[model samples]
Target: MGGGAWKRGGSSCRPTTTAVGEPVVLPTVTVEDVRRVGLPPSTANLQPAGGHVVLNVPVNVYAQAAPVTRQVEVLGFPVTIRATPEAFTWTFGDGGALGPTADPGAPYPAMSTTHTYTRPGTYPITLTTTYSAEYAIAGLPFQPVDGTVDVSAPAATVTAHEGTTVLVR
Candidate 1:
């Protein structure tokens, strides 16, 4: 009955709410969100634990990973995520493979995780590390996500030769 207001209930008791432009928009999460987390940088360190190893001898192979954790925003919420080295899989490149184990073999004396080469040859060793991921999103107690990702360390080269000892008189 007054300004450009619409009345309801067949009476001017209260005016209907007027449109106030478009509602504010908020960003939604997508696969691209993963890019923000990205694949973690190289974290594993792979190499032979001893200087020289003989054929049939268990050469100690070990890998280490750096600790990574950060609080990031995901789906417009604070998400705490952590990445840790879970296990390591080794490929001796000598037509043999080691383990996807959590054990990092000790030095020469103790071979916790090792491989025995049957013959003498130069080999390129590689170690692939699996990472365990844990995440907790703030305000979303029932929606927790967990997963694993793998990253490989730089390849290491090793030379293997038959054991020999010479004593001259």
Candidate 2:
């Protein structure tokens, strides 16, 4: 040795490594609360002599964090009411007898329409609303997320009452 004496069993060599950086947390999507409201109490059992049945559905939808757009449709036996975020249309029977067009006189935040039932019978009417939101993560709009709700008409009983006589048999 030129400078100093070397030790044979003094220390042992070991490998070393290094980390890049801290982990990143990405943003997530969360659906807000949704609500629905209907006009005319959503229940009517009347013995109309003849004519069509007109129903009005007033809907209110809100989102806490993001803006949401939705489509609504009323499903029934003799009729079907369909509405998009921009417009609404009504169809009669199984055919496209009515419309898929927009009505300028319809209400906002709510959709209202008149349905004509050809015959008198009990119908299970359902109003369905679907909501969706558009979001972008990396400068590109991703696929939208959606939600829906279906409301059915209440069961009704119809009977005629005659004057005085108490018909209990």
Candidate 3:
């Protein structure tokens, strides 16, 4: 009897034949541990001052992976991202100025702008940004976000002291 067939007594048994292909029952791979990488942080540290206020606003563009670039439009202002240090400045009405013109370090990507209130009242403060052309990791290029803070001088307090002479004893 040939090796391809099995012989049982005088009867010959044919070899088994099976289709050659991928397995009919294959394992599946499900998505595991999904993580979000690009999402900018909203600005904070908005307070009031004497007819004016200094805002320590933090600006960042969503970037995934290394060297990811993106543009952020704040209040219809377009800001390009060459580096985190380069940021735009926004003033309220007018008569306000920015702080010292020096590198304040990096990693805390933000810009400082002083807003001077012409009168003592409340006003709306807006912040905007525009990313560079290379920046595309984020959603769009123009976005306007704003936060309001009251600007008024501290209320004044006055006191009067009374003194008595020896005749009052």
Best by lDDT: 1
Poorly placed runs, candidate 3 (over 4 Å): 1-44, 48-85, 91-112, 135-169
Task: Report every candidate's CA lDDT.
Answer: 0.58, 0.28, 0.26
lDDT of 1 by residue, 1-169 (tens): 1123211112121232337844422223222232346545443333344335578766777665665666666435476656676777888888888777877555556667778888888887888877666554553332223446666777777777698676899
By TM-score, rank the candidates, best first: 1, 2, 3
Cα shift from native, residue 128, model 3 (Å): 1.0
Please give the ranking of all candidate structures by lDDT, highest first, separated by commas.
1, 2, 3
The positional error of residue 160 in candidate 3, measured at the CA in angstroms, is 29
Cα error, residue 12 of model 3, in Å, equals: 69
Which candidate, 2 or 3, has the higher lDDT? 2
Best-fitting candidate, scored by TM-score: 1
**TM, every model:** 0.62, 0.28, 0.25
User: What tens digits encode model 2's per-residue C-alpha lDDT throughout 1-169?
Assistant: 0132212212212232225544423232222211231211122222232222322211111111212343222121121112123222322332322232233223333333434443444443332223333333333334342443222234332222222334787
Candidate 2 clashes between residue pairs 3 or more apart in a chain or in different chains: none
The alpha-carbon root-mean-square deviation between model 1 and the true structure, to one decimal in Å, is: 14.1
TM-score of 3: 0.25
Writing each residue's lDDT as its tens digit, candidate 3 over 1-169 gives 0122211112112232238743322111111100011223223223332223322322221111122233433223243332221232333333342322232222323323333343443444333322111221123332222221121222211111232334653
